[model samples]
Target: MAPSIQSLSMIHDSQECIKPIPAFSCCYLLRSCVRHASLYIGSTPDPARRLAQHNGDRYGAAKRTLRENLRPWEMVAIVSGFTSRVAALQFEWAWQNTKVSRHADLDGNATQELGVRICPRTAKEVKRVAKPRTSLTNILANLHLLLRSPYFSKWPIEVRFFSADVHRVWQVWLQRVDGLLNDGIRVVTDFAPDGISEVEGKELLAGAGRVGTLDVGYNSIKEYVEKSQFLLEDGERINCGVCKQRLILQHDIIAVCSHSSCHCAAHLSCLSSHFLKDKDSDSELVPREGTCPTCYSKLEWLTMMKEISLRLRGQAEVNRLFGRRQRAGTPKGQGLKSVRGRGHSEDENESDALQVSTGLDTVNLPPCSDGPWTIDCAIGVLGGIAHRPGGVSSGNDSDATVTPEIETHPQRCRRNQNTRTQRLGLQKSAMINLSDWYDAEVIE
Candidate 1:
């Protein structure tokens, strides 16, 4: 027979019924900030002892909570399954410093690294911290390196690929994977056969704690190649792709490879020279369009150059390939297409592009807005400023002048930037509940 409710409760809540916990490890979140479940992330091996440490009758509370004067913090989340203490420490560090960590999502989304966004209504979302702009080629190179890093396998994280549109993000990544396999890019580069390392497995992607990367490939070339992969706009970097030498001069009409699957930018004229040098078969009908030295995609000179001339000539092409904002009257799945049909050959130029266009059309792009201010980075210049060094409020106020040198610290500059952004009050909208990233599905 089932035990009575009173008897069951008594046994379950008894001290003897509690299981023993390990020592020397584990990070837990203490939810004490709210009246119900306040949130604070921390790590300790012995949760029982840690709880006692936070609210001990003797000794003192941790410095983080000493100011709050809140007692009896309850442990709500416990992260386990780390092989070593260093790994746990690494996780704690990333969680605390989410903005700088590669594992954190700073997409101006209302998500938290800890998996649960704090108080749904009261939590102040953090704004994105800016970094210097970089060339897409350089960025992709670095991303490729990190993807193959041993840390990607050992560390607990997820790598999410984003496009301007979420559905397209998945499509672009899959296409990249296929291109690498079918085009033999895997033979030259360190890309894995399946595209992910085996050892890292689930921990690397590690569920909701995914690290987001971009399909920054298509969007960031020097010039936008609209409507036609046939024609390319002027690119920023041009070295002899074959010799890796600087082009003799600036006005070289480069002959770039015309493979839509691979946008390998090279000195076009240099490529033709290399093709002829290789003793590749040459004729008027089938000119030597030798393989691209970089991506190894087969190239035919006639198709590479001819396909382009037939496609574009100085077009704005805005709102052409870009997904549109979804309107209320639109039908569901109205703009979807298969990735296979989307791949157009030189023969199917206009028609194939039309098919690709269907899937590319999106309804609503996430709105552009400001990010939440990082409070730690907030400038406290006016708070009790009278006694700060060099500030002579106590002396003659009229004679005081604060030079720019006073705010030279990199840390202070960050604080000032954050403060300035906070004063501006620009912010984006949310796709899902920041409160529970694990359970919430963001559909827009």
Candidate 2:
């Protein structure tokens, strides 16, 4: 006999419970056990499984790694915290093509080494140039350059070294580099992927110690999310600590204080602006971390962003913590799209719909704003200080001179260009009204 509707629903729920959540994308460095100099770089959602694949112990090995000489392969390091597989893939491509990639720091003169001589060389000259061999040091240097590049610097990427020797080399490079990496980027050594003890994870979460392993960090984030769920449920009305505006849980992207006892909560953009107040606003669109407006406790921007991403994907654990039930007819992995389509009007542009579906539409401004800020307005406000005509001082110093050196800094110019491009992209795609785009869905 055919199953009843209730039975089918139970079956569906059981399958959903057991369905594995998508893992975070990571880019890994692999070295042949037989030949240490032979290396490969790739990105995958499952690092352990991918390592096995490369070692020929599993099916689906890459053609280059399937050779008998490189029988066994070991992962030297893995870079995690990429938001999507596409982002990880882009990083992998950039790493693989550093000499030609715009993200790399290779000098224009260096391009001649690949065979572009004065007045242009022939094809034979290019072939005779003999491509330079990629060394471990060169790989590490490129990795450092890519992390500091404007394209990937804003991401909360982490580099985890599984090999002691490689980790040591990474440290040596860090000491030799001209500038320090952003505080948000983590460099972990001797990282254990197997998991950590619960007691140790709790200690790390409590600020008594730092997370030394991947599992411990994941557990700490999970515990923090559980705590946030309780706080969100307890409050009848939550307001942004920075902007003093009401926050709608399902509709608005919000960030909570990392301190367990601290009840500070704020809109994502408002909190980002608050943290960037002391920073070079013109050069940076995102802040690495900041003190909580209410608690004055330090918070990591990466941790907050991870929590929001998890919520957007509607992970099973997040749903359980928030006491949310998936509707019977809703398909898997479309939770974000369903939530976005709730209050969207039919007349909205396709670009706006696409932006809303990506879960970034609410990032531009607070919900209570009368009108969305245009790209030009955002640029002016974020620029911090406005210069008068003819380079005159806006301050009381009538004789103050403007330094051409500071105005013409290459790094500063590149940063300003990147920031403006990002703002323009957001303004063009996400100018819809938040109030009309999302309706508060009461959770019982």
Candidate 3:
């Protein structure tokens, strides 16, 4: 017997005179691109709508997963249509469990609920939806896009299968990142500021790999600056000079010392170091257990360091670039009367075109190179040194051969001088002629 038209349709028609809430069954396929897994689950009544809702941020109990990492179109294996909603829900719960769900009991949901993910339309599909290149710049750009995405902004992404597991991972990564910044330690790979790059994403994954619970101590964060290296030391608590009770801000100028009898605000770094010896000897500690010796309160070193360091570095880069552009605008033959004030001669014009900026003064860019250096700057002196692997003999400023030593080998010195002169070019001088110039702008 042919099935009724109402039973076969994707959407329900209320006027069809079908049995109330007619039950149907179907199977849906979900593949996780991030984890590279296949999930087969069943659903009831209207599978299409249910699948769509699960993928979207709005409808599914899986909304937490959807908001943070999953995208709607990523679900690759969906074959819906089930005999009943209860049966469908049961299948969904079973599929979700193929992994782990630590918080399953609290939500009153099945342990094995289906999570949304992305995948190719079929196993045979070879093309990738996103480009494979993962350079630092591209990763940062992608993070910026994610930050502005509607999904990320809507809800707190529940990445934790169990509350304790996820929270613990996040807390540790945050601590390491904070500690480095506070100590003025800059990891070149982490060149971009926090929140601006995908460091959060990378750290989240990295933290998960590290197996251990955090052992944090609440104390003042102390550092010893020795020979340009900053080392972390133990924290101590002292009294505030003004308030006269206990204080934690060890360095703040409270106008008085922690001890009421001696109103001096200073405390020996050595004295504080001794006080912290009672705590754990581990190099890293949690900021909370750490206290401001002067204020006797929790030390929030990480939050402050991340914010301050990122801002300062960001501002420095901008200022350095700005200075470069300003210097580049200077005309090519300013002081050279032979080239400019002398006459508007053809030879002078040709000489001007050959001139290029030696980007030595630009601090933001990498040291310039003859060919390897992207910026046309003087920092390329480093490149000239490489040309002669034999190494140049050095001397004083009158005959300073660029290198920091005094030696003979006048011919080598001459060669070095020529390289420097050529690299310097006419970038700093006034224009010999307008015709000699070619347009150049700083890369945005």
Candidate 4:
């Protein structure tokens, strides 16, 4: 329409001062959030206007987009602030072809840093390892991005993370969540390392049209870092069909198509993009119509999604909750002392309580632990063994008596000593007999 526009496109004249219109600029991703999960990318002057065109409001919509008949599309992301329409288009081109751009200003790292994702048609990886948002560096970077947005000035966003409760967050159960709140879609966001269902969940929840503000980040798994690994054998081979990387981890989303003849296995996200590309059905409602890349077998999305979800639910769930951890039991060979531990009785010593509980009241307890009422020590003092004049006799002092004349008479003394010794020996013999009798009675 203008001389400058014409010169930029067709005119041979290269003028330094002549600039194209800088007002037109925007790049967007049109993605099916819920069922189809198709992604389309392009640049436009007005996103809303271009969206209407894509929907066939003006002319026929894109053949690929309309072929799938899933209506009510939502703009997933829009990147603006380019200097001109040409710049925006170039950006789109860069996004679509990361290695093809010949422009001097464009770089692969820059494009990648801007969140321009490339879904490979072939394999080189198992799963796309996403960084955790809880990392300090990532948290600060996300914070910077959040602070840059103008929406936060008016309506603030709050992120709340819940610790893993072994039952819900870590285990796979078939029980259905009975009721859902009618007001808004309450999503369980487990953003862990890989974002919860990636971008699909966020877009779905946002498009729910709830009146109140919504938190789009992963809601279920941020509070904990489940440092777990694969439960499979080392001999088993697993690789992502898209990235071609080894799918060695349990956390990896491995999706396998069971077509009997063509059992094609791939990472879930990798197969998702492939599913869209290989889809034969023109209707989006007729899901799971894609062909397996390896076997050409028809891929049913419902079956694939079900299998993937079930596996992902099972993968490392038990490990996250009840996997190998240090046992809470007391260490081996070391005796358990209950009194020192918390909430123990302050009135009695723990050792005393232990001895009492084990049926080893006073006699069996070692020295420095004997109770004040122990019969062995009390009887020792009363029998003159502990209070002996010269020194305490090592044994048989319970019957011997001290007298002025009794010590002079050797025969009398010997008889008294023998009697004392006999009496002490009898007492010990009687004690053993009584114990045996009690044991025999109990056995009977």
Candidate 5:
């Protein structure tokens, strides 16, 4: 029987409700080709589509970029690695209003001076301070300052420059900047081929041609999630590698070792705390990298987080991983709805909902003990220093095996009060707005 129009609408709504949200957000820089001085800064989950919207090829473009005079726009660069869309938006707002933002002062005066005293300013005095002009120089300077700010310094952020001219300016500014960017933050240059004309660049930016090549440093979420699926399927009780406590699949957020041979598993909080111990700063909620407890392999915290994101929110991937096929006659929306309603779920649908409802599930795991192997020790072993009963020895008996020195320098840590709480908050907020980026159909 043919379904009614009302029935079709209901099914569509149901499908939209269950759509999986991607955990990605980035702040982008756009310049008006017509007027080189005119620039715009915005944030979005998808940069390519956002660029198209600004060029009048799609809907939902900001009023500022809609004028015929500024008909075409070019993306200069993008800053990614924000923990959430909210984080990216906060950054966007700060970048747009740098002069008044509390982050403007480099001396820590603004943050510390707040609530100490409020000297009233006259209308004339207020009017005397001109608004900071938005130029390429000022924009890059503010970006440098914001990245160094204590609030954002610890984040594993990466800056990618798509324009060769802009990248040269950035390089010059970095030398002039007072302080250096955090070691964890990466600066990438993905400029188009030399001798490419302005029109060619525009075509690339408009999605008609490939722009610059992106050098992805870590494993993608799909590959990471698929490889780690055995942890859920093995049926053996999994325990936290740090705390040595059994991991409850439905209750605790889990992180697995990225190394293919290693099967280390732990509560997200437990792993985070374990990684933070190596640094001088304990106030941080995220660690850039740490040695695995089981295999002693170095693991990137950002990579693990990406895998966790897929496990938590990627419904289609999860279904495929578990071999959960829909019944032949069932509607797609109905099939997804049924998959979500099962209790003690294999798909983690219930747990994801619970995490959304509550801020985050706090797991009270015991403090991590010192690991038997350190990263230095692992390096030494890989360098042909074999471990004997007492200590490590070199390849030759006559040669002395110098002990590998552990890193003592205090590395900066990414600070946030709560780990899981903020992560879950990101997931919840991102899921709600997933449709905004995904549902739109680009004209080109």
Candidate 6:
């Protein structure tokens, strides 16, 4: 039987339930900001005591906005299975400070991290704060890391992924996942292989907290290629600097080189130059067992120069491939032809020749009307102002300045430029969300 809220005071008298908490241990707390509807993440050694303090409104801290909102069930525990308490604490702190929670959806759409399994508490019970055991700590650590990601920023309230096996769901969900991204919804969760990394997870989480719009999702270079207009010829080709082979540009083999320096084809023979150069005076080039010469930086100066040329050529090819896609009518995924099937080679020439409408075809602009504040009126006013003489408008021009000597301030101009650059930076980042492209219709 579950304990009732009324029994909390009596339960404190009992000694069997509570245990001593370890010092400097790690655990996390996520409080919902009532007014702003945003989430504030935190962590500490004693979750039970810390939560009781918040609910009791002990010090009345401003950041603790959920004092009155804590229900009996909201005092749930987050369990992690770390090998040590220190590791748990480190994971918790890193999670709160960075992309772990924010990018949860992209990390894998794990919703459990944001979970609040509230339980009744009493002041007496709170005095002895209970620390989670190892199993619980590890679980919590996983949850925290998974939740902090760009994709999971907009996670629906109260959802989390809990098992490693859940990752298989993604393989089956590929189509649905792509649709979500195309519709401007990015989901992140820690169960994802990439999302588990401490470095990437924290980076994404910090990004999401700063901007509510950052959505986390599983992303890869393959996704980029498939979604863009870069073409591949053969799937087997490798993109190593020395390889000069024709390849079907599939997701795995898109890096094969068409450059001049290390123009080896993608095959066992492609790595010969690298091996032959690196071999000792007595060593000969052995088939199927050679490392790269240029990239390894192990060969002679002349060979390095040759490798450098190959690298440059590789970069140029990459630029050209992407450039061609831009000129083509298709956006990202619609431009590239993965297999040789329809029409021509589906190269840039084909893409350029075709006409395509961008996704913003449905934007509705209000019609022009007979209003004093019309855009035309504004343009006409600007023209008249520019037509005025340098000193001041001669004869009763109400808009004319009295002083022609009021020169533009260089400092002010510089400040304005800086402001513009910052705004531009923000706008560019916002565009990555792709929110503007998505449209939902009213069923009614």
Name the lDDT of candidate 3: 0.28
Residue-level error in angstroms, candidate 5, position 236: 1.5
**Candidate 3 C-alpha lDDT tens digits along 1-444:** 122345434223332432222223333333332442322234434444444555563366343335435433222222222223454464455344422323122232211121211222221212333332211112222222222233222211111111222223233333322111122211111122345334344333222211111111111211111100111113445443323444334223122222222322322232233234435555533221234445554423332232222222233322332232233345553433422111221231122232232222211222333221222222232232112122222232221121111122223323234443422332323233322222222221
Reference-based lDDT, each prediction: 0.36, 0.58, 0.28, 0.37, 0.60, 0.32
lDDT of 5 at 1: 17
Candidate 2 backbone collisions, by pair: none
Look at candidate 4 and tell me the lDDT of residue 187.
Answer: 19
Q: Model 2, stretches more than 4 Å misplaced? A: 1-23, 108-134, 171-183, 191-213, 216-218, 278-280, 315-444
By lDDT, is 5 or 6 better?
5
2 or 4: which has the higher lDDT?
Answer: 2
Worst 10 residues of 5 by lDDT: 354-363
Candidate 1 is scored at a TM of: 0.22
- Better model by TM-score: candidate 3 vs candidate 6: 6
Residues 1-444, candidate 2: write the lDDT tens digits. 122457545644565444323336789887776676687899887776676677666798898899988757677788888766678989999988887889876762233333421111111122333223335655776788888887787888999877655676666656556756776688877543337664443323222122223342244577677777777878589888988978876556678888888988887778888888956477788787789999888888777876765554546546554445533433343224212223433231122222212111112232222332211110121222222223222343322221111012122223234554543433344323222222211111
lDDT per residue (tens digit) for residues 187-250 in model 4: 1322223355545444432343221122221112212112112222344676665667776443
Indicate whether candidate 4 or candidate 5 has the larger lDDT.
5
Residue pairs clashing in model 5 are none
By lDDT, highest first, what's the ranking?
A: 5, 2, 4, 1, 6, 3
What is the C-alpha lDDT profile of model 1 across 159-274, one tens digit per residue?
22311122232233333331221221121111213555433322232221121121211233223234233334443444666767654323333456555555555555567766
lDDT of 6 by residue, 280-364 (tens): 4243333222444444422222222222222222333334334545443324542123112223234442435533211111111
lDDT of 5 by residue, 1-444 (tens): 122457545644565344333356789888787775678999987777787788887898998999988768888889988876788999999888776788767464232222121112211112232224545666777888888888888888899888766777677666555578889889997766778897787666545233223322222555567777877668789888998988766556678999987888987778887788866576776789998988988998877876775566655656664555553432233223212211322342332321111011111112223212221111121122222232333333322222212222112112332444433333343312221122211111
User: What is the model-wide C-alpha lDDT for candidate 6?
Assistant: 0.32
Evaluation by lDDT, superior candidate among 2 and 5 = 5
Error of 1 at 1 (Å): 57
The top-ranked prediction according to TM-score is: 5
